[model samples]
Target chain A: MGRVVVEVMPKPEILDPQGKAVVGALPRLGFTQFTSVRQGKRFELEVDGPVTPEVLAAAEEAAVKVLSNPVIEDVVRVADIEADAAATITSEGLA
Target chain B: MGRVVVEVMPKPEILDPQGKAVVGALPRLGFTQFTSVRQGKRFELEVDGPVTPEVLAAAEEAAVKVLSNPVIEDVVRVADIEADAAATITSEGLA
Candidate 1:
């Protein structure tokens, strides 16, 4: 199976109450280095075969049209999961 | 300023009703290639200076301790936003 990852974030001008809440809470939790926080959404989509360009195109279209609200959010990324390996931490390692 | 991006996902064994709803809705929206979908959270933490190793480490700690629930979610990634430039689509480009 192949997987595509999509990331969406709120527009810079938008007010993110959730992020504000997190930033407010972090200092109390002793993580005081962060000055601000912005919360967003990540999605993983699975397909039966390799992630072809056609699949990526479809995913991108879906990301913009269905996965995010253009008025408030931006489709920041749409890519094959393999391309994200360097950044992804497997749950086993954390376990 | 520097930004750290953190991604958190629902554990594979966990029931992701939001993902299921998306997967079900996709076909209706004419996106049929995807077989499954998993929804997750992405956070961007901002700091006043360049992202040092110490900042990255702190973000990772916050990702696990405050951003994610170990029982149902996995802290999949915690990286400098610069490292994500290749995948990130600036809103201006989309516009």
Candidate 2:
């Protein structure tokens, strides 16, 4: 099977209370260098086989239509994680 | 400024009802090739300087202690997004 990952983030103009709360809590917990925090959703879809372009396209469509409320959010990234092994090996040179 | 992204996902044994709902809805919505879905949280932190190792470590600690319920979920990925530009250039070669 393959995995398609989608990241759904709130629109820049939207007020993310959860993010604000986290940001507020950070300083109290001694993480003072941080400036802002934005919280979002990630969905990992497992398909029956290697993730193809069609699977990505459909997943993107699903992310936009059902995974997030488009009026206030954005689907920022859609990645075919099945290809990650090659990319990781190229970047980290891990065998 | 720089950004650090933390991905929090449910443990393998945990039942993700929200993900299940999405998987169930996909077929009804005409996306049948997908077999499973796992939902998670993504946190984007905007820091005051370049995302250094210290910042990443603190963010990782925060992710483990506050961002996710350790008893139920896992912090799967902690990324220095400031370094993404270099990686993207290497991979996609976008100027």
Label model 2 with its docking quality class.
Answer: medium
* Model 2 chain B worst lDDT run, 10 consecutive residues: B86-95
CA-RMSD of model 1: 5.0
Against the native complex, each candidate's DockQ, computed on alpha carbons, is 0.40, 0.51
The TM-score of candidate 1 is 0.91
lDDT of each: 0.88, 0.82
Q: Candidate 2 chain A: minimum summed lDDT over ten consecutive residues — where?
A: A86-95
| RMSD of each candidate relative to the true structure | 5.0, 3.4
Error of 1 at B81 (Å): 0.7
**Estimated TM-score for each candidate:** 0.91, 0.89
Put down candidate 1 lDDT per residue, A1-95, tens digits, no spaces: 98999999999999999999999999999999999999999999999998888898999999998899999999888877875663333321222
**Positional deviation of residue B33's Cα in model 1 after best superposition, in angstroms:** 0.2
lDDT of 1 by residue, B1-95 (tens): 99999999999999999999999999999999999999999999999998888898999999999999999999988878875663333321332
Colliding pairs, model 1: none
For model 1, the stretches where C-alpha displacement exceeds 4 angstroms are A86-95, B87-95
lDDT of 2 at A46: 94
Q: Give one digit per residue, the lDDT tens place, for model 2 in A1-95.
A: 88988889999999999999999999898888789999999999998877777887898899998899999999977777645424433533311
